[model samples]
Target: MARCFSKLTQTSVRIEVGGGRSFDCPMLPVSAIDEFDGIREMLGSVDKPETLREVFRRLREMAARVLPEEYAPGLARFTLDKLIELVAYLIYGDDDDQPAGGQAPADAEDDLYEAKKK
Candidate 1:
C-alpha cells in the first residue's frame, strides 16, 4: 500500500510498501525532525493501529510454521499489540509488561498429561 500526503504549509509526504513486506519511503528533511518527533509522540499513545495488524499477522504466520503446534495455538491468539510489544522488547531490550506469546513451556507438558487422564 502507498499513501501520499501534502498540506498547505508542510512538505509532501510519501509512504509506500512493496510486496506487503517492506517499506519504501522518501527520507524526511533534516528540518522536519521536530515535526517527525511530534508525529511519533502523538502516534505512540494510540492503541495498536490497524496499519500494524497486517504486519503482525504475517509475523505470526511465519512463527507458526517454525513453532511447535502446542505453542502455535497460543501464539495465534495474540493481538497485534502484544506482538508489537514482544518485538520491541526483543529488539530494544525494553521491558514490556505483556507476556510473550506461545504456550507456557512447562504448562504444555502438564496439559498433555491432563488430557490423557481425561
Candidate 2:
C-alpha cells in the first residue's frame, strides 16, 4: 500500500540572544547544507576539537546570510557560546525554551498513564 506524506512546514524563529538582542532567522533548509562548501566542510569536521572556532564561525556566517540586515550588529556582539547555542537551534530545530534533545519531561510518562485511566 502507498502512503501519502504531507509537506513539512518551515518557519522562521526569532532568537533572543539577551541584553535586548534578537535575530529573525529561518530554519536552515536541508538543501543549504549541500549548497555551501563551508557548511559541508564544517559538518565533516565535527569530531575535530581543534577546529571548533572555525566551525562556529562558518555557522555564524551562514546564519548571517539568512538573517535580516538589522541584526548584523547583534550577531557581531554574540560570544562563542551564544553562537554554538544558535547553531544547535539551527541544526536541531530545538528552541531554547524546550528541553535539550527534545525529550519530554521525566513525569510526562506518568501523566500519560494517568490520562489513559480517566
Candidate 3:
C-alpha cells in the first residue's frame, strides 16, 4: 500500500548544551534533507579559505530558523560542530551515528527521539 508523503510527522528535539541552556526543536524529516545536503556539500568543498566563512553563514541562518528568539541571539556562541550535529539530528535522528567513542565533540548532550512506528 502506498502512503501519502504529506502525511509524514515530525519529532520534537531538545538541544541542551552546558550551563542549563536548552532549545526545544520541533524538526520535520522532510524539511531536513536540503539543510543536511547543503552543509555536507559545503563541508566537502573546503579548498578555498572563503568556504568556511560561507558555511558558517549558512549554518547560522539554519540554526536561527529552529531556535527560539532568545536562543537565536546566542547562536554565535555555538561551535560549528554543535551546529552540524543539530542539523544532522534533524535529518538522521539518533541512529548510532556517533563515533566509536560514544560521544559528540561538544559539551552538548544527546537528545534522542523515540522510535518511530513500524
Candidate 4:
C-alpha cells in the first residue's frame, strides 16, 4: 500500500547543533509537508530569536522528561531547520491535535501569515 511505502521511505535526520551535539528527528510524514512548511516560516520571523543554547536546553529537558535519556541528547542538538520540523511534529503529531479528517488547526500560520494578516 502507498501508506506503508511512504513510511518506509521516511528517514530520521540527524541535526548537528555545533559543539559536537546532535539530534535525530524522524522525517515528516509525506502528508504533512505543508504543515511543516508553515511552522518553518513562522519560526523565521522572530527578531533576535532566542539563542540556540536556550532552545537546545529546553528541547533536551523536554526530551529527557518525555523520551528515554539516550534520545534526549540527539533531540537537543537539532539544527534550526530540524528543530522546526520536530516542533511541528510535537505540536500537531498527536491525536489530540488531529481533527476528524486529520486537519491541523487553521491558525497554525507561519510568520508570513502574521505579517500578512496584520
Candidate 5:
C-alpha cells in the first residue's frame, strides 16, 4: 500500500558506483520534506555541486536518520559521480543534468555549470 509522489524518481533509486558496488536509495517519507529543504538551503545555486561530497554525506546521514533501524554504515560509501547523479534524482526527480538542447560546449554559451570568479 504505497502512494506515489511526483518529487521522487520512483519507489527507490539505484545508486551504482561500479566494482560490484551498489546502493538502493529509498525515497524519504513526507516527514522528510524539511530535510530536503535543509539540504537545498545548504546548497546554494544548484548550477553544480561544488560541495558534492558534502551533499552526499548529508544525504547518507539523512537516510540513516530516517531509517535508523535499517541503517547499515558499511553500505554508505558512494563515489563522486554517482553521488552527483543521486543528488540530482533526489532533488529534481530525474537525473537529467544535460541542458534541454543537449548540445556540447562550442563556446561560453555552452558552459552550463561554469561560473566565473570576480
Candidate 6:
C-alpha cells in the first residue's frame, strides 16, 4: 500500500550532542512535515514575523516526546542554542554552523544546501 510504503521511509536518526547527551529522533511524519513547511513558508511571506517561538517550541515538544528516557534530564538543561542545534542535527545530520575539519575559519563554506538544489 502507498500509505505503508511512505511510512517505511521514516526512521529514527541518532545524534550525539557532546557532553554525553544524545537522542534518537524519528523523521517527521508526513503531516508534521506539511505543517513544518507551511509554517516556514508563511513566515517567509510575512513582513513582521511572530510566533517564531511557538514554532520552535512545538518542535521541541514533539522532539521531547520521542527522546529516549536516558536523555530526558539533558533536555531540561538545554539552552535555546543547544535545542536548535539538536533540532538541526536531527533533521540534517550535521550542524552547518560548525566548521569542518582542516578548513580555515574564513575558508569554511556554508553551501551544502545550495549544492543539493542543483
The candidate 2 region of ten consecutive residues with least summed lDDT is 1-10
**Tens digit per residue, CA lDDT, model 6, 3-64:** 11222333455555588664446644444555555655654565543565565565576556
Every model's Cα RMSD, please?
21.0, 9.2, 9.5, 15.8, 15.7, 11.9
Which of candidates 3 and 5 reaches a greater lDDT? 3
Q: List model 4 lDDT by residue over 7-112, tens digit each.
A: 2322434434478665544534454556545544554664545644554454444334434456666764677666655555543453223233333333332333
Best-first order by TM-score: 3, 2, 6, 5, 4, 1
Best by lDDT: 3
lDDT of each: 0.41, 0.57, 0.60, 0.46, 0.49, 0.50
Superposition error at 42 for model 4 (Å): 11
How would you encode candidate 2's per-residue C-alpha lDDT over 1-118 as one tens digit per residue? 4332211433445566588665556766766545355655665767777677666667677667666677655766677667656655654454332232343333444465579889
Models 1 onward score TM values of 0.27, 0.46, 0.60, 0.33, 0.36, 0.44
Between candidates 3 and 4, the lDDT winner: 3
Distance from true position, residue 86, model 5, in Å?
3.6
Flag the better candidate by lDDT, 1 or 5.
5
The Cα error of candidate 2 at residue 109, in Å, is 24
lDDT of 1 at 56: 57
lDDT of 4 at 116: 77
Better of 2 and 5 by lDDT: 2
Superposed Cα deviation of residue 97, candidate 5 (Å): 14
Order of the predicted models by lDDT, top scorer first: 3, 2, 6, 5, 4, 1
Evaluation by lDDT, superior candidate among 2 and 6: 2
